[model samples]
Target chain A: MFGTGQFQLYNPVRVIYGKGELKRSAEIFGVSNVLVICDPYVSSNEYFKEVMTGFNSVFIYNKIIPNPPCELIDEIIESVYEHSKGAPKFEGVIGIGGGSTLDTAKAVSSLLVSEGKLADYVEGKKKFEKRLPLMLIPTTSGTGSEVTNVGVYTLNDIKKPMTSPTFWADIALVDPVLTYSMPKRVAATTGLDALTHAIESYWATSTQPYTEGLALRSAKMIFESYEASLNGEEWAKDEMAIAATIAGIAFSQTRTTAAHAISFPITSFYNVEHGLACALTLPTLIHWTYKFISEKMDDFVRYVGFKDVEELAKRIEHMMEYSGFSLKLHDYGVKEDELEKIAKVSVEANIINLTPGNPKYEDVLEILKTIY
Target chain B: MFGTGQFQLYNPVRVIYGKGELKRSAEIFGVSNVLVICDPYVSSNEYFKEVMTGFNSVFIYNKIIPNPPCELIDEIIESVYEHSKGAPKFEGVIGIGGGSTLDTAKAVSSLLVSEGKLADYVEGKKKFEKRLPLMLIPTTSGTGSEVTNVGVYTLNDIKKPMTSPTFWADIALVDPVLTYSMPKRVAATTGLDALTHAIESYWATSTQPYTEGLALRSAKMIFESYEASLNGEEWAKDEMAIAATIAGIAFSQTRTTAAHAISFPITSFYNVEHGLACALTLPTLIHWTYKFISEKMDDFVRYVGFKDVEELAKRIEHMMEYSGFSLKLHDYGVKEDELEKIAKVSVEANIINLTPGNPKYEDVLEILKTIY
Candidate 1:
């Protein structure tokens, strides 16, 4: 039976999706002067100039680092102040890049209007009440940061995830043309990230019918398009672009479950890419969580055309292998003895509590060691 | 292949769904003084008083009529003004009961803040830019009016459908307990209305992946729960409530297709209920549209667990027979010659153009005669 639990669904971000739709950014943002936060690689892309053509004026900041630090956000804000004489006059803020650029843009937009450092809000010392009109355009398909109300920033050498009402962008422009330039490795990891999001959101203890429907559909598309997307097929990339955003919107409501919670410690400790780190544990977690969600897992398997949960698990492992990544945690430099530490760190995440059957430290350690 | 056409998905209504969520309306609305628009039947329900227990004060207008008219809304505004001595002071507007009550409340809230008669906006003479904080509670599983931006109102003896940004309620409280009291007839018709929404939204030429996923999932639930819901099972009713809202959100983005367009004429000409009127054409149109959307319809059939589109169509016919609704329009007082007039009227609705293969007057007439 579908669970009869109470839940709320609200996503205010207007997602405009299509091929080559980036050209309409000026019309969609409906503003003139704007500040754009993007990755350095994005600024040098051949098609970048055309994307900014309709804007009357723009402030470009392309010094985005992965897992953006709070100080980096502060530095960007200070530079904006120094450039604008402390009276920044921009009608909107646009985030254009991967997760780091988009996450930084979320903080920058809120801090420009509110009084505090990014850390103040990240640390829970303050709340963001409002921000300028904000738009997020993802250059890669993996980080649904463009549509979610969540932002992750590094502070004191630890990743701190925060949610703010203002972080939900006014518009999420998903132009698949932007993702066509991703390297094959980027494609694989990010594709896996989208897949994990689909599965985790589908089975999260907080899952509702609305999110469950989205997750099922998103996962099906990812399974169909992951291989073709890595081969640089525009049609497959287009499907992946839409699928990733749909998955993002799914997790945006349910948050995520053990997969996401576990991925955090693995990424923070091993320097593995976020999506790759998440996928490393996914196959094992699929088996581990089966007893708790057997019928639901069966439904997911059937809807996505897998024979069973085992095949679903093996397909993900196959995707990882095809992408040239070893499935074992030891291959990523994790010592077998360090499994307990990863488990300890994973359980510390608040979201891990949302996992079905509520896997404990020992359970997590067992799953980690199974993969190692 | 999934189409790469452009689309925008934005639903700002916070849908709070649970078995007994109606009691928390006060906390969710976060307002003291409120204007309530409800049906006369609702005010007499045994649980009505409990729903209002947490409110500071409530001004209830319960003389709601089916197919609410423009004069009735103007009268509601006049009564509020007369009661408050020229200035109407309400922190929010709460709409309870069926579609008519909810649709009336949407207009009352917007006209109170923006200005002019409801007709002024319905006739496209003016626009509504804002409304009081609005909350909608569905007492039936059909209509899905609570979550959608579209509202139908009668003006000058014609049903006019209008959409505005302000009509999106701040909250949609879908408490299945509120639907527990629906009569068997209401359950069957409303269930059919929801099923039609799911199917039409899935096959509409304007369909996108986001809505297709929702439509598929919702149709599955409706198929599973419709018969049991008619038997007054609470679990089935709970599923129906969620299914209906999901279908509403699906059509809210895609705006529906031929079945809905055909429905408007049938609903207006005959005194049949809106849901039944919509479903009368559904099975016939399902077969008629199959050639144009064969693969997509196959996908829908497979996902919803039907053998084929023909089997899907037969299931709807079986549902009508079980509900005691006649399969022929002649039984509803439409003369054989009137089929032409109904067809002429059906084609007049612009939404018919959104149908796959774009059925014309002759095509609609054929489908109507087939159903008869």
Candidate 2:
């Protein structure tokens, strides 16, 4: 029941959430040649194809890579332009996959109407003039990219993820049916990612009462349901899916902080799954910063159904181990030689400022070393 | 801690909440000549006048009456049309006062652009095509009319609160400073009204996860702050104000049930204040329907910081007596001869169908008898 002095919070997207909601996509997006952007893995699923049968003039752009690359975005834009024959086209862009695919869709939608390159819209200098009617359908329950105003893109040469506020999706369809198909590992990873988003947003310096309520609720849901979801329980899976979406909305209002800042570089450099990378750093980050943000940490731990902060970190570690996720960077093929570059790259990344406690360069190096 | 089935919940209204937010109205409303709607009682307040000074070309329409009569609405509309000269029309309608004034503003705004009378929009058959941009500023921490989509008006010799799915204000400016001038009775009555809205909405047949979360939080706030607010504690006043606004949004989505339905007749016939009537019937209504909606009742008691249902009811009774508000109809000058007419009118109200527990005619009579 914390008070937010004064703030403006609004997400104007109409969310249609249900098992068969995907079938009504055409009704929601009327009389337009649709560009459906999806992960190749998800686009290949038979169920996704079955849902696509209801729509007309649909173009499937399924080349979205995990930690989406700019080249793939260029390819998508060129394909849309080539297919449309110079007419003001693509009535809508429907993204169907994990956060990466959704990010790609957001980027394409944002870049379609703007005159500049994708880099111009990265991290606050968002000059997005117009966005094609956008709809995001998340496959995994984590990374609530569907309802967020952020899109994380990988710089091919630098190997770092860049984010911007201009990347808000017009519609975020969170259907639990999409999550049931995810393998246990994917669920575990994405679930952890959602948890990290909630945790970071809850403790972020810029957080308000509105965002904190959603973040706290989301963290609680993830902790309560993550184990059962990983154990293949149907009810828990549904809850996790909803929790992830809620977390996305929460973090969307207040972008992720310390853990996310550290995790991004690890993912870019080591190719660890985004959620797992964040999860690995979260326990360590919380342990280090607990003294600075102790009250908030205590609230988070209790909210997530833990006795204390230590137990909460242990619970996260236990879940990661049970889900077959690697906690140490070494397990993910990070050599001793790569540590310095990884640390330096992380410091240079723009997310470093999001760390409220202002961890020094040595602090960042120590956290990376502990995880390594 | 509760699981909401797949649902999307986000309110996009820019909420400026605090002590001095009212003074920022000119900035929020931009350069529009503001059309301020308020109860005649509030128009005379020095604080109201001070706040109104910030707006340019301010037009004060203080004809709003209790239960918001349709004749008053017609007069306001005529005034707006005649004064605006068909150019530089009201950029927005700012509602400043209790639920009546706020509800009147909602109704007027909805009708400003439409081609028909107010009655045409009754019961979802809205023919009011266009609406002036609208903002609601509530002076009481009850009714929650500022953040809700329903408006109650006494029309055709009957009091009914009609709801429209599309009727929502662009901004709901909730400032606790405005509530400081409320008398102890006003505070107690309105606070009870807010509590009733929360409790009834939580037990509503259409209650979903989003509404439950908000209702639970609002109920807790009311329980903790209502007495303190009545005692003239500034901090409690702010919290209760926010709680009422949140509860309003919660119940607005899932309309009120038995208590609200039954309370309307008492206000209409006996001339009881809306909040006082709502408070008088709440305890009896809860006791009567507890068996039917026991789960919700238990939840309500716990959330409202009561040890049990009986305790919650006793607390309400104590508060009513302390505030000098009458709990029995006889205290309010309702003679024995008028009971049958009040009962008949209460039974005839269309809202009887919305009672979640679906009380029988005998049950309604029994509830009235208990209050009597």
Candidate 3:
């Protein structure tokens, strides 16, 4: 609880959560002609159709790709323009899927109002001046993108991203019922994604009391519920959904660190699920970062209900094993030579800046080598 | 943890916490022409002078009276319009002081943008639209008004009246140094105000998972630190300040209930400090509410580190005794005849709707009788 401390935590989205909150989306969105964005899987779900019954004027864009490619966003913006009669104006934007679709919705809404290419707005290059009313409904419980002021998108053949205080969702509808339909593998990967978010945000260089409190609670929830949720236990699934969303909000504010940074390259190159990719590096990163901030690690371990840092790291490894995710980078088809390229790209990633204890490039390489 | 079903929680105001965060106010505010609405005490503090140093164009409105009056807010708005030559249009509004000043700042900013009287926009009649960019810096660490979407002001000859969510501050700066200057009595009463907020919000009808988590943390912090902070202990003071603000944010989302409703008459009639007045009825309300929601009370008791509900009630009694606050209605010069009138007023207050375990008028009367 004590350290060389100063931090800021702020989340400004109104969240409505429960079993059937999706029913209220139309009312919540008001009279706006909404641009409804989702993944192909989500767009075809029975639950999605049920939720969309009353929303007659919604324009569906189900082409959102993972990592939210910049071109996909441009396509959505063009669709919005054509559908809205060349005005490119939507009364509101509704994203109803996992992080990718939600991130795409945010980027499209921001781009719809701003006067520039998507790359011009990456991470503090320019502040977003205007955005349509953006509402997010996170069906997967990972990527708290619904309530965070961040939208992570791949740009210029790189996983570079941008964050602006202005990029927040106006309303976030998190219905646990939406999460109940997820496959076991989807549940596990997303749950691990949320866990990584909570753990990394708690230890990020910019962690604040507000975020720390949230991240701790989220970690505790995930530690207790992630496995149960994957096993299709109802109570645990409900808790996991809540925890994932909360952790998303937490990391969205503080930003993820080395594990998330290291994860991007792995996910992009190896086609690993984003959550699994992040989870793979998490245990090693935690062990390494623990050496620099041992006391904070102790707090984190205790907060997450582990007896010690070693126990926590072991639990993370066990979770990855349980998920059947490949433990070694080589198993994901990474060549021995690509490690250096990843290290170079990762060293420049935003997560490198967010990583607390400031691990050097050499330290990063060593961790990657061990995983390899 | 299991009984109370589903709820939503979201607050999207970035909180910057530490010593010297006040100096960064200008950077967060992003404008030079700032109107600083503060109380006389806060206006005179050296720390406030340090905060003011960052901005060249600053207007000071130091007439914030206890339980701020609506007319006073009108005066401040008129002054802002008169002073700034209508140029920058008050790029930012800064509130520095206790809840009254903070509330005044909220009201002023909200009113500046809206097209009607302040009272017309108190939750029901009209939705508050158009508020200038607002920042709040609380000195007392009580009221937690800095981070909340609430602004309490005296309205229609009533005390403890509040405006709606449109009053949410864009930036809530919680600098421990600002709170270090509060007088012991002020610290005690305001800290209790925060404690009441946490307790009441936990039991609020609208209490969601998000607010509940924050409320529980806030209650734990207040119970552990309020008394020590009252005695002018430095570390405890800091914790108490942070706790109070957190509680404010918690309760601001989920408004206050029976105890807060009961306290208004006491403050209006006897001029008791808002926090102490609210504290007087808390134990009685908690004890009564426990009968309806024993499981929830048990959770609260455990979270607050009490052995049971009895111990929790006793601890609150001990806090009042230690802080030298009068617990009896008689001490505040109320007659036996006033009890019925007070109960009538309490029922009339819309806050009765916020009471979680809805006590009947007789139940309310019984709680009042115990305090009396």
lDDT per residue as tens, model 3, B107-174: 88888877666666653576777678888888887888787777666677665455566677788888
Per-prediction DockQ, in order? Answer: 0.68, 0.33, 0.35
Q: How many clashing pairs per prediction, in order?
A: 0, 1, 5
Over the true interface, candidate 3 deviates by an RMSD, in Å, of 3.6
How high is each candidate's interface RMSD, in Å?
A: 1.4, 3.8, 3.6
Clashing pairs in 1: none
Off by over 4 Å in 2: A1-4, A30-32, A123-126, A155-168, A203-205, A283-311, A326-372, B1-10, B49-56, B123-126, B281-358, B362-372
Judged by DockQ, which candidate is best?
Answer: 1
Q: Which regions in candidate 3 have their CA more than 4 angstroms from the true location?
A: A1-4, A50-56, A78-89, A123-127, A231-236, A281-372, B1-14, B51-57, B75-92, B113-127, B283-318, B326-356, B362-372
The lowest-lDDT stretch of 10 consecutive residues in candidate 3 chain A is: A1-10
Query: Model 2 clash pairs?
Result: B114-B129
lDDT of each: 0.90, 0.75, 0.78
Q: Between 2 and 3, whose TM-score is larger?
A: 2
For model 3, what share of native contacts is present? 0.39
Question: Which 10-residue span in candidate 2 chain A carries the lowest summed lDDT?
Answer: A156-165
Q: Report per-prediction Cα RMSD to one decimal.
A: 1.4, 3.9, 4.0
Off by over 4 Å in 1: none
Top candidate on TM-score is 1
